[model samples]
Target: MGLDDDIAILATAPVFELFERDALRLLSFAGERRHLDEGELLFSRGEPSDGGYVVMAGTLALIPRRPGEEPVKVSRSGLIGRNALFRQVERPADARATEPSEVMRVTPSVMSRVLREFPDVAAAIHGGMAEELLDLVRGLSGVQERLTRLSPRKR
Candidate 1:
C-alpha cells in the first residue's frame, strides 16, 4: 500500500488514533515498512523482539506451544503486534502470516517519542494494549480449560 493508505490505516487504527499527528511524525524518524507472504514467520517464539508490527492487510496467527505438546493456534488478527513497537523483550509465541500481509514495523525510539509527545496517542495505545491483554487472558483461559478436560485424571 502507499503512504496515503498507510496513514489512513494508521489514522483509523486504535493505537494510532490514540496519538497526535506529531507523535505519528515520530514514526517518520524510525523503522521501515515490510511485506510478508502467507506462511511466513513474522517472528519465532523466544526470539529477541526489536520492534512491533501493525497489520496493513491480511491476517497473523499467534501459535502457542508447551514442552512435549503440540503447537496450538491461539488467536488471529488483521491488526496486531502494535505493542512490539514499545516493548523491550523477547516474544513468547510465534507470529505467522495466514495470507499475504503488509505490516508497519515500528521501532522503540519512534514509539517512545510518540508516547512522550502525545498523551492521547499514549492513551489509545494503553487502551488497545489493555484490550489485547484481556484477549490474551481469555485465550489462555480457554486453553487451560481445554487442557484440563483432555488430560487424564489421577483418580
Candidate 2:
C-alpha cells in the first residue's frame, strides 16, 4: 500500500483519530508492517507485548484464556494491543490471524516520539484513557454494590 493508504487506515483507528496528518505521516513512515497467513499466531497469551497492531486487512481472532469464552473477531480498522502502544504488558489472550491479514505495528518508542512532538494529541489521548479508566472504576463499583446486596443478611 502507498503512504497515503497507510495514513488513511491509521486515521481510521480510534486512537489515531487524535493524531494530525503530520503525526500520521510520521507513524506511517516509522511503523513496521507485518503480514500473516490464515491461522498464523500473531501473539500468545502471557507473551510480553512490544507494541500495538492496527489491522490493515483481513481478520483476527482474539481467543480468550478461559475455555468457554467466545473469541473476539477483529477485522480491518481494528486496533489490538492498545495499551501496549504506551507500555509493556503481558498479553491476556491469544491473537491469531483467522484469515490472511496485514497489520501495522507501532512501538511505544514511536508513540513516545509522536507524543513528544505533538503535545496536544498526547494530552487528548491521555485524557481519553483517564476517562476510560474512571468509567471502569464506576462500573466495578456498581458491581460491588449489587454483590453486597446479594449477600445473605446476618442476625
Candidate 3:
C-alpha cells in the first residue's frame, strides 16, 4: 500500500484516532512493514516486546500458553501489542499468522522519538490513558457494588 493508504488505516484505528494526519504519516514512515506466510509465528509468549503490530491484511491467532486452549483469531486492521508502545513488557500470548499476512511494526523507540518531537502527541496519549484508567475504575466500582449487594446484611 502507498503512504496515503497507510495513513488512512492508521487514522481509522481506535488507538490512533486521537492522532492527527501528520502524526499518522510520521508513524507510517517510521514503522516497518512485515509479511508473514500462513502458520508462521509472529511472536511468542514471554518474549520481550519492543512494539506493537497493526495488521494490514489477513488474520493472526493469539494462542494461549495453556495447551488445548482455543486461540483468538484477529483479523485485518487490528492492533496487537498495544502495551509495548508505553512499557517494556513480555508478550502474554503467542501470535501466529493464520494466513498470509501483512503488518506494520511500530517500535517504542520510534514512538518515543515521535513523542519527544511532538509534545501534543504525547499529551494526547496521556489523556487517552487517563480516560482508560478512569473507565477501569468505574468498572471496578460497579463490580464492588454488585458484590456488596450480594453479601448478607450484618446485624
Candidate 4:
C-alpha cells in the first residue's frame, strides 16, 4: 500500500492516531508489507519474535494451545495485531491467516524509534499495555476464585 493507504489505516487504529506525522513517516522507513494465504501460520508458538503487524486487509486469527489443554481460538482482527507487540519473549499463542490477508510488519527497531521520537505514540501504546494488563489481572482473579471454590474449605 502507498503512504496514503498507510495513513488511512493508521487513522482507523486507536493507537496509531497518537503518532505524529513525522513519526509515522519514520515508521514507513522500516516497515514491510506481506500477504498470507488462508490457514497460513504467521508465527508459531515459541518462534523467535521480531515485531508486530498492522493488517491492511482480510482476517487473522489468534489460536492458543497450551500443553495438555485444548486449543482456544482467541479472536480475529481486521486491522492490527495486538498480541505480537507486547510479547514478553516468544509468542504464547499461534497466529494465522484466517483468510487471504495483507499486513504490515513493524520491527522492534522501528517501534523503538517511534517511542523515542513521539512521546504521544509511546503514551498510547502504554495505555494499551495498561488495559491489557488489567484484563489479565481480571482473568487471573476469576481463575483464582474458581480454584478456591473448587478446593476443600477449612472449617
Best by lDDT: 2
**Arrange candidates by lDDT, highest first: which order?**
2, 3, 4, 1
Residue 67 displacement in candidate 3 (angstroms): 4.8
Candidate 1 vs 4: which has more lDDT: 4
Cα deviation at 55, candidate 4, in Å, is 1.5
How does candidate 4 fare on TM-score? 0.68
lDDT of 2 at 4: 87
Candidate 1: worst-modelled 10 consecutive residues by lDDT: 70-79
How accurate locally, in lDDT, is each candidate? 0.70, 0.94, 0.88, 0.71
Error of 2 at 27 (Å): 0.7
Which predicted model would earn the best TM-score?
2
Q: Which regions in candidate 1 have their CA more than 4 angstroms from the true location?
A: 25-29, 66-79, 123-155
Per-residue lDDT tens digits for candidate 3, residues 1-155, read 88988888787765776788788888999999999999999999999997998888889999998999999887776888888876779999999999999988889898887788778878998999899999999999999999999999999
Supply the global lDDT for candidate 4.
Answer: 0.71
Whole-model lDDT, candidate 3? 0.88
Off by over 4 Å in 3: 66-69, 153-155
TM-scores for all candidates: the values are: 0.63, 0.93, 0.90, 0.68
Where's the lowest-lDDT run of ten residues in candidate 3? 9-18
Candidate 2 lDDT over 33-87, as tens digits, reads: 9999999999999999989999999999999988999999998889999999999
Full ranking by TM-score? 2, 3, 4, 1
